[model samples]
Target: MIILGLIAGALTTGCWLPQLFKSWRTRSTKDFSWLYLAVFGTGILLWMIYGAIKGDLAITVTNSLTLTLTLAVVGLKFWLDVLKPRVRARAEPPAGGPSQRSVLPVDARAVADGTGDPARAEM
Candidate 1:
């Protein structure tokens, strides 16, 4: 039964990955409901507290890990969609620069691989 419970926990918790990845790739969270994550994560945190009080290892571990992963997604959503834009706005001006037209912003791999052209890389 513990094995089954752990498996279920892992399956459900793992669901966050694809959504997080989608948000990361798109650099947008317009489709994701922030309020839902906040509420649901609060419930998960409460469960972790309950598990601790009951000395239930399975519940505590599962909910603790889930809460961490959920918070990571929320942080990424804020960073990629919200803070990144403000930083980008500062980097570019009305006249524009060469960095503006040739490519979108990119990760270090693109620069390290000597393929600074993100559009050509199809990332």
Candidate 2:
């Protein structure tokens, strides 16, 4: 049972790295939803609390690690999307307006248009 528990924890926690790396490489959070992160982080906190009450080592350990990673992602999102822009603007309000974001979001409409589907056809 302990081995099974460890495997379960490993699978869940292991998935966090790729996500973290992707975000780090991109350096933009335009594709991530603030609301989703908030709700997910809150759920992880609740899971930790529940694990403590139940004396479940697996839950406690897994959620503790997950919470740490989750919070890091949230913090990164806040730093990149909110705080950094304001600091940049104040520090060097460009002669023109603020420069464009480092990354532009993928537009669904453009993808659909390219697909040549009748639904995407212009009226």
Candidate 3:
């Protein structure tokens, strides 16, 4: 029973690794909604607490580790998606600043047509 519990716990907890790795590698968590992270993280915390109360080693350990991984992903999302953009915006001059130049050609049809799709524009 103990061995089975260990294996199950490991499999469930290890599932978080790939997503964590991708978020770190991309430095973007744009796909993760703020609401989902909040609710999911809260549920994990609740499960960990329930496991502790029941004196279940497998549940407690697995949830504790999973919570740590979830927090890391959430931290990356907040830093990369939320904080970094704000910092970059503050660092950059406002649009139409003297140093700013349009990347599109002056005769770009997308600009004239108001399509707003840079890819559709003729360079």
> What TM-score, over all chains together, does every model reach?
0.69, 0.72, 0.75
lDDT by residue (tens digit), candidate 2, 51-120: 8899888888998999999888888899999999999978874676554652344455756667654445
Clash pairs, candidate 2, are none
- Candidate 1 worst ten-residue window by lDDT: 96-105
Q: Of the pair 1 and 2, which is ahead by TM-score?
A: 2
* TM-score of model 3 (CA atoms): 0.75
Best of the candidates, lDDT: 3
CA lDDT of each candidate?
0.81, 0.81, 0.85
**How badly does each model clash, as a count of residue pairs?**
0, 0, 0
User: Which stretches in model 2 have alpha-carbon errors above 4 Å?
Assistant: 94-123
For residues 1-123, could you state the per-residue lDDT of candidate 1 as single tens digits? 778768878888888878878887887877767898799899999999998999877788888889998898889878877898999989776565566545655566876798776556544
As for TM-score, the candidate ahead, 1 or 3, is 3
Could you tell me which 10 consecutive residues in candidate 2 have the lowest summed lDDT? 98-107
Poorly placed runs, candidate 1 (over 4 Å): 94-123
